[model samples]
Every structure is written in structure tokens, then in C-alpha cells.
Target: MKNLLTILLLTFCVSVSAQTTRKYSNEFMNIGVDAAALGMSNAVTAFSHDVNSGYWNPAGLVHIEDKQLALMHSSYFANIANYDYAAFAMPIDNNSAIGISLIRFAVDDILNTTQLIDDDGNINYDRISLFSTADYGVTFSYARKLPFEGLNYGINAKVIRRVIGDFANSWGFGLDAAIQFETRNEWKFGIMARDITTTFNSWAIDEEEFATVQDAVEGQNQELPETTELTIPKLQFGIAKKFIYRYDFSILTEVDLNIRFEENNDLISTSIASITPSFGFEVGYIDMIYLRGGVGNFQNELQLDNSEKVSFQPSIGIGFKYNCIQVDYAFTDIGDQSVALYSNVFSLKIDFSCFR
Candidate 1:
């Protein structure tokens, strides 16, 4: 008990002392995940014997009964990564359990365009022709859950790495700790602090070194610049409440105070202070038929542009559970400057312990 309290206090201290983002390059958390995307915020309150507990909330693992494992993957527009996550957990003596999670974030193939300029003193011609790509972050997480009375507490730590073509490559770590205060009678509360590492990694400008070379349509000989490390912060800390009625229908809501570190804000501020609240409701009975809907704000900036902010994409989803197997699906439209992202996604989650 003493050690648990110490760990919780330390996690909060890390978040308070971490340095935030200094410039461009924003970290995102809304890209993928079935439950949260579809708006099951109501059900996310408890640690059900399901796999998605890796993202929406990990502390729920403390409630699992039998041993379980699951993998979730999705194919998105332009071949961009929708989500690839895996997790497993087993009970430890009844009130405590341990689990592990792995999540990979990826982007679609991109064209790396370089302009070919012809300065003939009379007419200058410019044509962009190149191929490039951008992607970042690979995470491995470890979590442990312990129960106290009717409540549960959990902790997760993730190691992250980011890579974007020749622009930059940064590696860092993150930590999230949460407490699930609940009662079988009716109400529940949840609190979590994410990205406590404020990771700093090295980045090299391969293009900057090449920018000075004599437009020598013939001199491709100079080497690129050496990389330097930069530390950036991307953090989210939130609290939520859930009300389960008749032990079936539920309503869940969360209010998050988010702080982003970037070069600048194309929509708000380099260090913007914002509040994001999400809501979800579920309709079903006997765990056989289910339907859910949810909607929240999605960032519309690239690295740091504070000029535009639009919100209006409510999500909808449905699933079926039979005995020890279940299947899920959701539809969400996510986008940016390059193109409008339209996604009709499906998820296949198997919770073999479906009441086992």
C-alpha cells in the first residue's frame, strides 16, 4: 500500500515538472481506437474483460477474470495506419492483475517533391517532382491493476519513437496513471495523466545542408547536416464520471485539460489552453446486441497552424457478442490539408471470456 501511494505521487510530479513543446510537430491521440471512436465512453468506465482496455483506459484490466489476449488492426484511406494494438492480461489472486500493450502509429505513403528550377536568365521554370513520407511513434506499454473495495487503480508506461522522412527523428517515453472509483450500486469516477515523459530526441536537417549546394544540375557531392536532439511535450490529463442505470444502459462524460507543444498554433496558440469534453451512451441488453454513438473535437493543424478549427464529425458503431466471441465496427471521418479523410472501419475483437 505504501509503494502504491508513492508511485501515484511520483507520476503526478513528473507531469508537473515536464517541459512542454517549444515549436512545430504535434503529437496526436485521436487517429484510431474502436471504443473511444465509436463513443462507448459510457462502458469504458469499468475494466471489462475486453482488449481495447489498452487505449480508452488500461486500469480496467483489474476486473478481468480468465486469461485473455487480443489484436486489433485497421486499413485506412491512402494506406495510412488506422490502428494496430495488442494486449493480454490475467488475474493475479482475484483482486490484482498485470497486462502489456503495444500500439503502432503510421501514416500513408507520401510524395517527396523537390522543385527543379531552370534559371536561364530569360525564363525560369519550376517543376516539383519527388517522393517522401512521414510517420512517428512506436509504443510498448506495461500496466498493473489493483483493487481496493469496489474501486480499481492502474498504471501504464510507454516508450515512443517518431520519424518524419529527412526532417526529424525523435524518440521519447510516456507514462499514464489512472484510478477507477466505482460502486456496483451505480456511479463511477476516472482520472488519468498522460505523456509524463516530455521526451527529447535528436533531429537532423538533411535538406538544410543540401539547400546551399550550387544548383549544380551536376554537383551532387556534398553530404547532409548532422542531426541534433530536441525535447518536446505533448500531454493530456482528464477526469470523468459515469452513471450506469439498471446495470445496462450507461452515460459517460469526460473533461480533458490539454496542453500542446509545437512551433506555433495554426488554429490557437503555440501553447494553447483548451478543454475537450466527450460523451457516449450505449443501448443493449444481455450483452448480445449493442449500439453506440459519440463525438468530440478533432485537431485540424499540421505541426502548428492556428488559423483553422472545425468540428462536426459524430461517430456511430454496432457489434454483436455470442458466447465467447465478439465483433465490432465503427465509422469516423478524420482529415487534414492534403485530403479529406473518410473512414468506414471494422474491428474484430474476441473476448473469449464472454461471461466465462
Candidate 2:
């Protein structure tokens, strides 16, 4: 027991000291995948129980009694991009489980033009071409119940890939670890360390493709740096409580604190001070339907010195379940105004154990 506590303390210390100034190394990894969890503002680190938990907190995968598969899709950034995810989990025994998940985000048909010919000299529309930019990650996860009752631990190993048209490509690897505990009185707590080993992305850029504009770019006083990106670790902690009423209704409330260590000059340099808090609630009608809502990303208050509104992005969602299949829909907050702030996300989950 003392040894475990010591290890945890050391991990926390290392995470604090490993802060970097490199930003957006693997930024796409921060986008929440599952619609249900996003609708709840990513406050599920302690409450997640479905296959999608492989991404949120792999330790939650231990709750799966059988085999489950999940898929999610979103048309993000005002329909300018597409994001998709798929996950599967299976219990190995009463005490352990394994899972896999895939995430993809892409923006296609981007017009590639070195110079807008019409705006400059020629009127050649034929010079224009289209290409796509994409980011992808494959995650393998394992979870096991600890010897101590109500305690669980998990880990995730991931491979990340990114491409920008035919100009640049990057590949990287990362690992994540998490622990969760539940109390007899329906209270749950969890901690997740993302990119625990620090993800690194090494980019291979085609410099020849930009040779034509190289002198012009230099004339503009902009110099491109070498192509390596580092992603610092992010720590997430959550607490949740469930209230069951009668036998047909239940309500769960959860909150999470997120501390991200990055190389963002726009924010303060201290890891402990750069904290974001999120809150969420879920109400269930038996096991058939669910309603959820939450708020997130309000930490700007600290960076902005409270000069601007905290911009607490809010989301809402609903889910329906019957027999072996479940379907969910959510409206995730994406912008400042209602007209542009909300995006639709859909997900489907299936349990094969019921068929057996």
C-alpha cells in the first residue's frame, strides 16, 4: 500500500516537472470522441462504464460484463471537418478486460494553391488542386480490478499518425494510464494521465514543394522551424455521485479538473495554475433512456484575468437503449453564438453478449 502511494506521488511530481513549451503537438487527441461523454463535457473520468471509456479512462472498461462495440461520428467546425471513432471491449474474466479504439479526423477537398493566379497575374484555374488533411490514432487498452475491493487500474498504448496533403506527414506513439475507485455509498473517483510518456511527432516535410515560395516567404521574415512536435502530459481528476430513486430512475452528477502541461506562450507557465474545471449531470429513466447536460472549457477566466466572459461552453444529449443496441445523439458546443456554437454528434453501441 505504501509502495503504491509512493509511485503515485512520484508520477505526479514528474508530470509537473515535464512541462514543455511546444503546443498542438497532437492537438486532435484532445477532441472528445463519444457523443455521450462530450455531451457531458468530458466529465466521465469517474462515471464512464461503456466501451467508449477506453478513450476517457480505460479503467472504466472493467465494468463491461461482456463484449461491446461502439461507433461515433461528428461533422465538426461548421461542417468543415469530419471526425469519427470506433471502440470495442471484451471482458477476459471477472477481474480483467481489454479494448481497442480508433479515431480519425479529416478535412478534405482543400484547394491547394501556391498563389491565387487570378489575384496576382494569370487567370489559370487549372493550377489549383485539391487535397486532404487528416489525423488518426489507434489505441489498445487493458484494465484490471485491483486486489483491493472497488479499485481498478488501466493503461492505453496508442499510435498516432497525421498528414497534410502531400507536403507533410508525422507518426508518433504515446501511453496513458488511469486509476479509479468506487465507494459503497455510490461515490466514484478517478485519475487519468494522458500521454504519460510524452507523445512525440516527427514530421517529414517536402521542402521542394515549397521551393517556389521559399524566397518570398523569407522576404516576409518568416522562418520555418524543424519538424518535431512534443505533447506534454495532461492530468485529469474526477468525482461523481449517483442517486437512485425507486427502481426506475437514477441521477448522476460528476465534475472534473483538467491540468494540461504545454508550451503555450499565450498562457501562464505553471502547470498547477493552468487548471480547467468541468461539470456534468445525467438522468436516466430505467435503463431505456437518458438525458444529459454539461459545461466545459471555462478556464479562459484565468488566462484572460476575468476581463472576458469565462465562455462556459454547454452541451446536451439524449440516448435510447433496448435489448442489445443503444443509440445516442448530442449537441456539442463549438462556437460563441448559438447559430455557430452547436454541432451534432451521433453514436451507436452494440452488446454481443446478449446474442450469446
Candidate 3:
């Protein structure tokens, strides 16, 4: 009992200082909406009241008063990352809602190899295997209205997992939360906390760096002479605002932030620990459809060298809602290739009302 708490404290401190997201991005980057579209504004706006709220801002669910279901999928030409997601939500009361969401990230066709030491001072390479990662998880979300009439809040906790290959896999837990406020139905604001947990599964670790033949499998590191437990962080935040025009149109501007607490140089985040700030905007017509765009991760300016610095992930998307059914599509492009490396996503939702 004492030892577990100690390990958690260490992981939290390390994960909070100058945390780098590159290593973890590949494993779960596409967990949200249309990859191509999300890629455009630096993947901001997780605190959105749309089909993607399942992966973005779980608190956004409270705004959806009717029963709803949505699904999204993306295709990447580079094949570096690919995935699909589906979700459903239902309002339990005026101030509360419940939902379930699923996610899958797949990395296909990887080369596998084995390293061996030759007779003397040489080395031999053996082709051992090839595999990719198929990670999936189910999330349960609950949203409610705060005591304040204009305030709404939500919470989501998920059991996540990553299967590298048939030989090894790791599982952990994650959480997301959000709060939103409105005034006169013309101006709205939002705040959210993302990925507040560093998850772990049964895995192994070695004290001395040496060739290993004894693979005891699950949590092998637990029995080693001495091993340090691994953990991410418990912090991430975002802020946003929405505007409505007299012409019956609206616009939304948002900034999203994630902080990796890299308090110390550890195996998880030394090579790449930095803060990412993203920007996004959306224009809507009659509250039924919208034209959206966003640019993210910019410390100074936007330039032509988008490929190298990601001046900003620029995206354009459209959305439609009728009779409580809403659908949205966003195109994410970064000048990555001829096809533009875009993500295509669509979602279907249903809404119902009671005590009217």
C-alpha cells in the first residue's frame, strides 16, 4: 500500500514537467474525430458540442438533450496511422446525460527483427517477426448541469488498452472532464481537462540492461530486483468561446492546451517535452449547419513551411442537423502529399425530449 502511493507520486511529478506528446501521440492521436479535419486546427476544440464530444469534451454531452448515436472513420494514405470510432449518447435528465464510445488505432505492416552477438566482436541480425498495434477501449461519460442555470459540466473515465503484438500488451486508465457556461444564448464559454491519467498494463521491466531470455510475461518488472513504476500525468486544460450574430449565424473560437509534467528527465519524456497550444474557429448558419476551420500549435506566425513546423493544421468541414439528427464532416490537410492526407468522418445522432 505504501509502495504504490510512492510510485504514483514519482510518476506524477515526472509526467508533469515539460511533457512531450510525440511518443504517445502515435498510439492514441486519432482517438477523436475525422483525423484529416482534426489535423487542421492542431486538433483543438475537444470541448465541442458535436458528434465528436465523445472523444473531445465529455461535458459537451449535456447539451444533447435527445438520444443520439454517432460514428466516424478516417483514411490515411501514408498508412502511418489509421483508425475508426463509434459512439452513442442519451440524456438522462435536463441536467444529465450518459454515453458510451469506442475507439481503434491500427498500425499495420511493421518489420520485426532479432539482434544477436557474433562469436567475438560482431553482431548478427535475425528476422524475427512483424506486427502492428491494435488499440481499443470503451468509455463511459456522464454530464450534468451545475446549480447555475447557465453552467453545464461533465466527466468521462475510460479503461484503455494497447496491444503491440500477440506477445506483449499494456492496459491503463484515462479521464476527461469539462465545464461550459452560457449567457443569453448568444455567448458561450468552455473549459476542459484531458488525459488526467498515466495508464499501465501488465508489462515487464529490467533493472540491468542486458540480453534477456527469461520472459515471465505479465508485469515481469514487478518481480525484478528493483524497478520503477511508469505513469503519465493528471492534467490538461482548454478554453473556448462562442458568438452568435444578429443575422441568425454564429462563430466559435477556441484554444486548447495540454501540459505534460516532465518534472524530471525520465524514460517517458526526455527526448520530446514541449507545450502545444492550438487555435480553432467555426462559422455556423441558422444553428443547423456550419462551416469550420482551425489552425494549431503556433508560437509566433503562420508560414509556408507548414510541413516542417506545422505552422498550423488547417482544416475545413461542414455540418448539418435536422429533426434531432446531426452530421458533421471535416477535411484535415497539411500539404503532406498529393492526396492532401485528409480524414473523412461522418456522424449520426438522435435527440428526444420529455416533460415538454
Candidate whose TM-score is highest: 2
lDDT of 3 by residue, 157-233 (tens): 87766554443445557676777766764455666566555444333332232112122121323222221223454
Error of 3 at 230 (Å): 4.3
Tens digits of per-residue lDDT, candidate 1, 1-356, equal: 23432332232222222233433222434354554335442234333334555554566666666766666566566555555666666666666667776666655453332233345533223343332333344443334544356566666665555554444455555566666666665455555545545445444444552342322324333343334333444444445555566976654454443345443432344444434444555555566777777655434443355455544346667777677666676655544322446556565555556655
RMSD of each: 11.5, 9.9, 9.6
TM-score of each: 0.64, 0.85, 0.66
lDDT assessment of candidate 2: 0.79
Off by over 4 Å in 1: 1-30, 35-37, 41-49, 75-82, 108-147, 164-168, 204-272, 298-310, 334-340, 352-356
Stretches off by above 4 angstroms in model 2 are 1-20, 115-123, 212-223, 262-272, 301-308, 334-340
Sorted on lDDT, best first, the list reads: 2, 3, 1
Worst 10 residues of 1 by lDDT: 11-20
Tens-digit lDDT track of model 2 for 1-356: 23433432232222222224454567778988787888898899998887988999999999999999999999976789999999999999999999999999998997655543554667576976777778999999999999999999999999999876665677889999999999988799999999988887777766654342342232322233456667878899999999989989999999998887643222233644367788999899988999999987763334445464345678899999999899988888755623344589999999997899
Give the 10-residue window scoring lowest on summed lDDT in candidate 3.
209-218
Q: Which residue pairs clash in candidate 2? A: 21-263
Task: Order the numbered candidates by TM-score, best leading.
Answer: 2, 3, 1
